[model samples]
Target: SGAVHFTRNNLSAYIRSNVRYLVALLVAGFDPSSGPELHYIDPFGSSVPIRYGGHGSGINFCTPIFEEFYKPTLDKRTAYNIIQKCVAEIQKRLVINLRNFDVFVIGREGITKLDPINQVSLRAQLMGNPPPRK
Candidate 1:
């Protein structure tokens, strides 16, 4: 689960096909100084905003949390923070709600597969142990 900001073109057939009724709730201000504008997409066809979005198996549970915690507008730094927190929350929910669920994050930079790390980290994070503190 993650959020993506489109640059210049908001062309993502994968997102459009999978996420029904995709809408651009907010758009970053045009900065001629900056290279490209930004847009948000929720891959599972949920909801959208300027700075936040997510998709995963526990999306129903995660969406509310994201909405509550997400800022209406966010700078690059804030966007990254929101993303990290969302990922952590999804990882948490997945561990408790299901035995196995893969998590993926995609953005302008690209997608990062979290299943392997999630499997190990979620167990420690949710299971209530510090996981060696290393």
Candidate 2:
């Protein structure tokens, strides 16, 4: 059976005991046949796969962005494109002092860190400007 495991933090444990509540969530697991998986855990601790997941102060404003551009069959490049576009909207419309973002890629080879997305790159893409020379 290809059941996805969705485990959440025992919230009752937090209310009864003084377990330190952390805002950030880490979702990781490996399926022998289906390969590896990662998720963004919500405050309630549900670990489910999502095409797009956001936490923090800008979620309300960010929903529209995801709604317009999200696709289920997105490859790596397309996924990053959506994320970049969302961040661009976030910076302009939302009040968060966001500057850049870090990207991490997961695959059969394991997780590999990628370059951070900065304001300059977003500006170029959003404005249709050419990429700067390496």
Candidate 3:
């Protein structure tokens, strides 16, 4: 349903909270043989993949959906859609539970954020429609 934004310095804290507060899983895609690839790690001290990854509540429910939907290697378009869908699902859960939640996406290009102001616009784009029928 939405996305969260944070600076690199806060990444550790974010990972810690996600592990502590929710059932978290990391879905990553990477080529280890490549020189100097990136990796993601959580509070549990597990690290893997790089090109693409995510963690949060309902991850168990959503991951299989992603797996089936995701390609082994993704182009930018595929990666963007996958991430947008994942975040939208998280946002839906947060709204249904009346909980406030945030999501972060990290990559070699750095992080892209969808905070309060632009989330709606971004979501609209993700859904492949013009912004809501307002």
Residue-wise lDDT of candidate 3 within 1-134, one digit each (tens)? 00111222244465667543322334323233442244554444444544444454566556766777776566545555565566566666654442333343344545544332136656568567643221
TM-score comparison, 2 vs 3, better candidate: 2
Better of 2 and 3 by lDDT: 2
The better candidate by TM-score, 1 or 2, is 2
Worst 10 residues of 3 by lDDT: 1-10
Clashes of each: 1, 0, 3
| Cα lDDT of model 1 by residue, 23-98, tens digit | 4343433444542344544433333434444334666666776687666455544544444455576656656644
Q: Best by lDDT, which number?
A: 2
lDDT (CA) per prediction: 0.47, 0.64, 0.47
Best by TM-score: 2
Report the error of model 3 at residue 12, Å. 16
Against the correct fold, how does model 2 do in TM-score? 0.68
C-alpha lDDT of candidate 3 relative to the true structure: 0.47
